[model samples]
Target chain A: MADIPIRIGIIGCADIARKVSRAIQLAPNATLSAVASRSIDKAANFAKANGFPPEAKIYGSYESLLDDPDIDAVYLPLPTSLHHKWAVLTAQKKKHLLMEKPLALNVAQFDEILKACEENGVQIMDGTMWVHHPRTYKMKEFLNDKERFGLLKSVNSCFTFFADPDFLKNDIRVKPDLDALGALGDAGWYGIRSVLWAADYEMPKTVTAMQGPVLNEAGVILACGASLYWEDGKVATFHCSFLSNLTMNLTAIGTFGTLHLTDFIIPYQEHEASYTTSSKPQFNELVTGWVPIPSEHTVTVNLPQEACMVREFASLVENIKKNGAQPDKKWPTISRKTQLVLDAVKASIEKGFEAVEIVS
Target chain B: MADIPIRIGIIGCADIARKVSRAIQLAPNATLSAVASRSIDKAANFAKANGFPPEAKIYGSYESLLDDPDIDAVYLPLPTSLHHKWAVLTAQKKKHLLMEKPLALNVAQFDEILKACEENGVQIMDGTMWVHHPRTYKMKEFLNDKERFGLLKSVNSCFTFFADPDFLKNDIRVKPDLDALGALGDAGWYGIRSVLWAADYEMPKTVTAMQGPVLNEAGVILACGASLYWEDGKVATFHCSFLSNLTMNLTAIGTFGTLHLTDFIIPYQEHEASYTTSSKPQFNELVTGWVPIPSEHTVTVNLPQEACMVREFASLVENIKKNGAQPDKKWPTISRKTQLVLDAVKASIEKGFEAVEIVS
Candidate 1:
């Protein structure tokens, strides 16, 4: 790719877009070129407050932002329900897509968005920031090391936050129409993604929702969990809720090793993140305690995870723009696999907790 | 009502009994008075190696130990299949009982042992050592604090250890006629107990075994997991295995707080244990990181948890012997509840991962 920085425009001034906007500016290869909202004042205020450069465009409508030819990519932070409509539009405009997760309401919608991106020869990636963290790459190294971690056996991940009364009633996540999947699409996306990441993006053979899911009056999920089973007997379980104290924990156990991190969705700090690893752990001779204790590994972050995400996405856009290179298939493939497993879980829940096969 | 220490006799030469023997010696109110085995050589050798006092009795047969009128209680570390026979014998002998877990082959046998205890007016307790840990009590204190932790929502616990080929082939836990429950009874006991502890011993309404449980040719489970659902929408998931690296993790999340610990079964060190807790955690303004990180709380052990267990059991025996007091119902009630949940999980697995209702 040439030295030209990727011009990144963000559609939707959702609260999350504020962080991604800063991430875009911090990304060396990406520039925050514009922001769009239904109201021009809201878009203008978001640009000024989020420190968009004076020359950065402010569009009153998403279509106006998409019409901007100079924009190399679009970061869509709209509610999940709108992902299919706006993501396809953004891709149709020949712009790369970086969209927030529960990528679409379900896999069918995600497939449509994917087809649009493919047809337009545009790159697409979900706004899953943690996977871009250096720590995640380091953990992946451990997981893939046969001598260290061995074959994966099981994994568990959880992402939950206690939603206040106002959020329960008014947040887009809890509203049936806006983000209809509710906690499953919101926090559960991270949990499912974390498990898939640990399994090296392998979709499970079966996904079965755990019994006793809590649903709100509007038929939006408040709390839920599911277990995923692989054909090789590897298993994963995840819990996500909007009715618990904030927790983000991911653990993967293998034949010879285990990987654990408490802040998996978002690290406790932006500058660095830590994970614990134990290879061939054993109990003390007396069975009173651990023999060789697990060791904590910390990775330094030069660019925060979100910034790394933007830089990676923009780098892909730059590759296509300057070198006429193809977009990396890894990101979109993983996104689809995560969505597929999530869709299976949702289906299992709808089918009264029956085991739902992952056809793909 | 005399101030005499409870005289405890050790039965069987299992490896776990070595630790429990030491615990009996350490308990201030418990005297390690006797050791017995199928052979005198093993009994004498075990007694000497485990630091039995010079005057402690050594017998060739368990019946000899049971015949000793001076022995006030028996610590039985026999395998699961032997639990019914030995536990009933100990109770029939009017000796207070502290038996290793999977208290019997099943609930029916456990009830038989309990009947013997009731008839003999003897106290009985399962050897679930972690619950006696001072760290556990401190964690309970936090859980009971409604202001800090609020209502219980969900819990997840895992306990696994990588067993060598020799263990898979020869360990009593894998033998159908011995510890028939295999990993479910061995490690899964702790996982289930941990969840029950987090839920304050409230039995779940149903138990559904997770899919892809790995079993040996003899139909013994080597690895399995289950999700438990409570009447109040509370849920818990547990995984246990003999095919993964050693990992013990217990996490309980509430509406306002969370408690997490990696070494819940046994601490990394015998002298101390730690748990992490977060109360009302929130994201920072940009949602890039947490506002306040969770805090780690550590509890020092004056006596190892096993010794604490021995001390508690011996104290109950003292009340029965000296004060003529009836046995404490709390320990038996919880043990029964844990066993009931385990039974439901086992039934769920037998019924092809169906959700089995907890009759009680």
Candidate 2:
């Protein structure tokens, strides 16, 4: 809280890690004190490129990086297959952890990480940076004003993109070690998490899912859809696809009206949204003089120079320093619940879209 | 095929009958030959007001109207409680039948109606007017063009409105004879039928549904939702609400892009629709940038005066005149399939959103 920079270690020198590394240096109370990767050259290159301080340690392996006492926290940008292992190990080392989008391949693995964090008295957070973004928080604020939209009725979200064949060879997105987690986990997770968060983390009472299996590759699910329901009759429908051209859209419908976000997954320099009432009654009655319901709004956000990941990690470190881990304690529960929903999606796919209930 | 007029009898003086009567006058080859209601005065008043020939028979009851041999076809706009009764009776009377939607309360009733029409050599059709609209046909055109939108992914539809308390008092929509058929039969039928029609009548392999029970009315379901799955991994979702204020919107998403129609039930005269590819490299990127991908298009259609009933009756009459009966029809088969889906929706609601498979 007093502007003391929190020491941080980088677990991988991937593209995302570089961006986060730069962000750490820019944050007021955070320092990127170390770098690690499977390749020594890659780690040393990243440390030199970022101008790591003299005290900054360079390690050839993630385990050795976590062993550094000077590194107060860890940022895990490992491949999808390695997230759970390193996340649990980082927690066991008593280092606060921030792992990428999906916390694990399945609910069981996520629970293990949660248990590790609990036993070690360390914090674990899924690096869902979008949730920490102000625009998403703004959308949540708009949803809370019942007078504006009435009872939330439904949410529909889509996140899709085409994957390059070359990138597909060794990419964790196409690898089987991740265990049935691909588009739904990589791209679809943002859409799913947005819906769940918009609904105040209320677990869907029922879920039905369908996925297109990859014909060219074995054990690859390319496109997936799921419909989740709440006890109060609210429904959320989501679609994630890796074989399609790029697209990201989210729509929330309520009894009174509907709201749409043109780009949900990516942080747009200028984001656009629209809201329309159910009836368009006045427009109908004034047919001769009718003007289209001006239903769109575009907002420009001045994002901080820091990467969303670095900002979130720095925030967590500051929270730990101020409140001694209480602020970072709620994330494991959220991450575990998300993994459970993902597991339900997989079960539904395996059983021919049989409706699966999230047991909480 | 010639310009020969078909004589039609109206078997009810309800609001729907008024609309149909007007459509018949506007149709080049359809004649309003008779009018009927529970009260002779009401029948006579409707005939006179609608400019039916002075000699046109005015029957006090539907039975008498069906007995009129001069009436080549009968349009039935009775409540859901009466649809099966009148449909079967019309078929038994050897009259081509046009029945309003939900076809019947359940699959068994629909089967009975189909059997009755088969035995009597009569044509039967559900008055599902939405599919008959030119806009719907245009939507189908867009869907069939693979280069434009690619594979169908999902269909979302909503049909909801605030009903006058007076209309809800004794109306079959609010209080159907069979307790199982509530809003799921009334407005929900349209939403379900839309999905079925859009999906090319490929009955979902499985369906899961949930409904909100009417607070003051026992055995009445108000709001309902259902998630449907197709064998090819396509998903469809439908939502209907009775207590909510008026609103209707439908959207269909595909692999390449999305098609959005604001008012699913009754679109405004100036209604426009647009298609946009998600911000990735769309398969049709070259084509999209050249023309702005046509965000929206306004289609001109003279909303058929009595849209559903008129279309159904005209189609049945044409079929009967061509083949001496309502030719063992494709329309009837489609209607039967929709009824089965609707029945599954009801079953799922009754079982607390349990999955229901659509048996052939």
Candidate 3:
């Protein structure tokens, strides 16, 4: 218990795998021991570049990597469309898994993966890296401190970027099987995950979606608008677009005041965040002489923490070793619910941005 | 073409009636000649309070007001639940009519109103007061000028306020017959109207909506959200609430920059609006080179434009006289389309925020 390192095997040598590889090397208890890619040349190149021990095994296929006896766990950074197949196969191998955002293309697929993991007694954690970031923790802490920011009213977010044509060509994101809600699936997921996590995983009771035309492939939504209705009457609205240029913003408004955080989708370590709150209207107006809240406050967060994906995977390993279960009991449950919401979004788009409910 | 005073009659002593009364008294070519309410006492009180002529007729009902020979036009401020009934009746009297927003609660009702007006040769305009305001005109002009603000990407608006318990107690807004989406019927319409008008009435090809719980006997909607999908691939999302404190904001993000205009629901004349746009990112590096677009050379609009609404209405009337057809081909058509969108919102809410298509 003092200091135990988990031997981690990464399956898939995509751009994200490199970040996870570094995180594994950095984490005190996580050691990246092996890596696999669809191509042997790519796997060999990645392993040699990362200086994996000579004994570390490399495979051209994910299944061969999963079969390795020395690999304790596997990180799956495969294309979103392939998340389910690999996740289930990894769980069956009894290997703990770290799956990427949009755990699957649909709710049914996510449920299937969850069931497989549960049956195989393998811990699974979604690679929603932002959720594991310290800034997110600080955000929750700030939101919960009613004395700091009053009753939460609404949250609005926008995360979009114009993609290069090369990035779109033959990308799994443009594949028909994924039902990608374009920006909603690619960048919008960050905003969705942020709000769902910040709001204590309260699944929106109702959802309405509006989408623009296909900017790339048919049914590949370029822009989408969503309205989420919460049980306590809190409302959140978000916009995701691929047709527009790069822009990211997140705003949380409460009774006492409001909070605006930019670059919420990415780590604050890489990008700076700014916030402002109204001053004239007192936070605690009931307190006769309560010092008037500052009209606005702007601060940048600078922190050195493990990469998001790496941190979550390491935490899952630690949680499994200590408690024999995932750290957050609600994460998997809410994650599947998020997938259901995404399904509704796709349905809404197909039906011309019609409202679609997340049926429990 | 000689200057002629426009004689107007009031068909209901509603809250909107008061606003219209004020606007009429302030318009140069418009004069309020009569007032009507369901109750004689209310009609008499309104007529006396607003300084109507000593002989100015006070009718006990809308029908009696329409029967008055001296009245040239009628402002129908009836509840949305009853708009169709009074609108059709008033149009049948061949009186130029200005009906309150939403036009009618449903598409069929709106069609009936328009058809009745056409048959009777009466000029009818939806009482969308904000659309006729000088500030709105200025905003449109600003958007249209490429050098000022170009290539609108998205528009988001919030029109929210807590409803007065006393007012909700007696208001027809709470009645089941209203087919009201509560906050949506009450305020969300304004947000939708703004986006639609700003985009030149390009009807959204599809729409979806989510509504919060109904809290009172009047079926008051606590909160509502809607997404509109335009044919040209533009998307707009909005939120409205009546269960919480007041907050009004409108933000339009464009390719060049963003325009943030607060308190968009109320006439800008009642509030001051300041906008900041930067081509150089002033907030952070991610937002770099977003300098504020200067407004020094932009046209300034002086409001309380004495005859803004009356003038627009008169222009419509004159256009009808000249063209021997609908004033602006877009007016009635867009009004009907807007009603259809509202109906779709209602349907989405009723169906648990399910996507509802805007059938032609």
How far off is residue B344 in model 2, in Å?
A: 3.3
Q: For model 1 chain B, give the 10-residue run with minimal summed lDDT.
A: B1-10
lDDT string for model 2 (B1-360, tens) is: 575677889888876576567777766667888988999999999898877877789999899989988888888888776878888889899888877777888889888988988898877777766666666777777777677667777777776654557756665566746434667777788888888877878888988774343433556767777878788877777777665545555666666655666555555543333233332243231111111222565566664424434655675677667756536578888888888888888788778767788997
**DockQ, structure candidate 3:** 0.10
Error of 1 at B53 (Å): 1.2
Best by TM-score: 1
User: 1 or 2: which has the higher TM-score?
Assistant: 1
TM-score of chain A of each: 0.98, 0.89, 0.87
C-alpha RMSD for every candidate: 1.0, 5.6, 7.4
- Is model 2 an incorrect, acceptable, medium or high docking prediction? incorrect
lDDT of 2 by residue, A1-360 (tens): 367777889998876676567667766678988999888888998888876777788899888988988877888888777877888889889888878767787777777888887788776777776665566666676677677667777777777665667756666677676534777788768777878886878888877774343323757666787878788878777777776645556777665555666456553332332333332233343221123442555444444323555666677777776677554656667777777888888788888767788898
Cα lDDT, model 3, residue A266: 54
Candidate 3 on B235-307: residue-level lDDT in tens? Answer: 7777776544345567666554455554455532332333333222232333221223223223244434324
Error of 2 at A147 (Å): 2.8
Computed on C-alpha atoms, the DockQ of candidate 1 is: 0.90
